[model samples]
Target: MTEILLLNGEPLHTVTPQLLRATSYAHFSSLQVRDGKVDGLDLHFERLDRSTRELFGRSLEAAQIRAVLQAGLAHTDGNASFRLTVLDTDLLLRIEPPIAPSTTPVRLQPIQHQRALPHLKHTGTFDLIYFGRRAQEAGYDDAVFHTAAGEISEASIWNICFARGPEIVFPAAPILNGIRQQVLQRGLAAYETSPVLVSELASFDAAYLTNSIDPALPVAAIGEVTYAPHPESVRTIAAAYASQAAQPI
Candidate 1:
């Protein structure tokens, strides 16, 4: 078992069978940790606050969580994945191993399944994972989900970004607004914040996915349909977030 987790500063739990099962999805947010710090921690906190209200019709107090974590966490390992969970009456925190992100851009097979509460990050996301794994299995690298409305969304784990010639677009709210999107917007790097279609994607120059974990990885190909990344733009934007993945929160 790949058991690696650091809670606060102590080794609280792991995915090991000897420990508890991973089957809960409350108002929560997962942080990308590298070395000894959390990436976009402020953003994660913001997301945790917003996601809690959006997902559970309640709000999570940052002060409370920070206090709990700072006082109880015990990190006894190296880099790991950390999750903060909050419920109506309870708050739980866990740390685990980092997820594997594709090193290169990925192709896509359109999956037109946009469910309710798409804007709110749902805990259960197997279909998304299945798409990614399937892409990798088929010798591709990623999967972009489309909808009757056109380009419904992309899964960047945190947020999805698409390139259409001179613009970097993202699906509007009701699809996914993840914290990363907010950050990108702050950087004034986001454009076309509206519903997108698969056909429109082809009309564009290129596309890629972004998140706390992966930051930015160009879209090498799109399904059986493939396109190349704009070397200059991809490099400049990617450079902005290259260090973010490992930046100290």
Candidate 2:
């Protein structure tokens, strides 16, 4: 679980003096590397490419990016979490032991804040972390965000999904379109995107959260509206996600 940081192909320490005051204008992706294999590696690469273009006004060479990821992963084994960051032209890859989110059901607190550029996975360290900690202190597992109009967008680090009988529904507002969500969309038979109002949490049968590392985690409650964890739907989506073959990066 030791820290392994790499810039481009060269190794760097976590406390590198230059990184201490680094600007926050960066795009990144968080993925799980198990036994040197990665799930949705292609989608992860696509995300980096899209963000690089949108944020930096240029494209990152694919072979170069792959080489950098390979270089960083050389120092790790077993399950681990990897975060690839692009700050200007510098490609930063940090690897640590895998940190899985809670498997148990979680409660979410609604926060009325929306990201400026919801599509790109840019550096949102301050507001997301602050609000997450605030929610934790207030006895919630995490915070879900909504627009001023009460349209649910996403969570601090996860995408929200709703179960309406046998179908799956996602919030139609702007979101990061997470890699895990993409994989699920490919595997699930019935899913649609619609406006999920924050004030209308009780209308759904069940809810769940998805991110890069975890497949599907059931939601227990949001604010005061409690939901009985729907294990069948969660298992179906989880199995479909697990069936996705991991590729070497």
Candidate 3:
């Protein structure tokens, strides 16, 4: 929610927020800032370092990360986001945010057999990397992208969250794992997502989406998929976060 601008190692008093309160979900990077604060900064950095190694066959030393961040800080002011991106050359660099696009929580048409490469928090979905434009033209916010086997993968920006009877179910879609997913795992809550059919939307209690920037919100509807908020699970997650923050950093 804050903007820090730096032009070539010189800091600016302010930088316009390209996507403040906006949802483009196209930029390729993890969300370091959460609600005006950086979430699990150390963990994100560690993952960043590791993901580069995993995906690019290279590892960045802590010194390298610190150097880049220091360089970035010199150019940025307070409350700014740090973005790690791969340019057209596939060479990674620290840059300002990406082009923000229109975002809408779309009712998804379930697709089948889509595989996700879950980059351990680096790459975007394989489909987004491949066939996402069609989803937009179909008059849906996005596709509730599923695996070729019909297992739910995720949305363009988040892990697909489904509310069933009394719990939140997150199927094991490792290919699309991101930062928020790790946070949910650390939080004690009753949720499970098994292999499911797209037609099973009728039986879901509720649905929502999650990414690093937004933690949780009940789904309004998903192409006739609807339900009330799963209060208990929400409360459990809220309490878990409160307890987590109150602990020593």
RMSD of every prediction: 4.3, 1.7, 7.0
Question: lDDT of each prediction vs. the true structure?
Answer: 0.60, 0.84, 0.54
List where candidate 2 sits over 4 angstroms from the true fold.
Answer: 14-18
Query: Candidate order by lDDT, highest to lowest?
Result: 2, 1, 3
> Which lDDT tens digits does candidate 2 get at residues 1-249?
788888787887555666654546788988888877787888888888888888889988778788987887777775788898888788888888887766788899999988878888888668889899999999999999999999999999899999877678999989989998998888787688999998898999899889976678888999999999676776768766767788787
Better of 2 and 3 by TM-score: 2
Tens digits of per-residue lDDT for model 1, 116-160: 567656566777777778767777655666666665576535356
For this target, which candidate reaches the highest TM-score against the unseen true structure? Answer: 2
- lDDT: which is higher, 2 or 3? 2
On residues 1-249, what C-alpha lDDT tens digit does candidate 3 reach at each position? 244443333454553464221212222454443233455555566776666666556775556554545666544343345665532213233435422322443466565544434554434446564445666576565666676666676766667776655566776654466666656656645567576556677687667666665666455565566556567666766664565441111
Q: Which candidate ranks first by lDDT, i.e. highest?
A: 2
110, model 1: CA deviation in Å?
A: 1.1
- What does the lDDT read for residue 229 in candidate 2? 64
Name the TM-score of candidate 1: 0.75
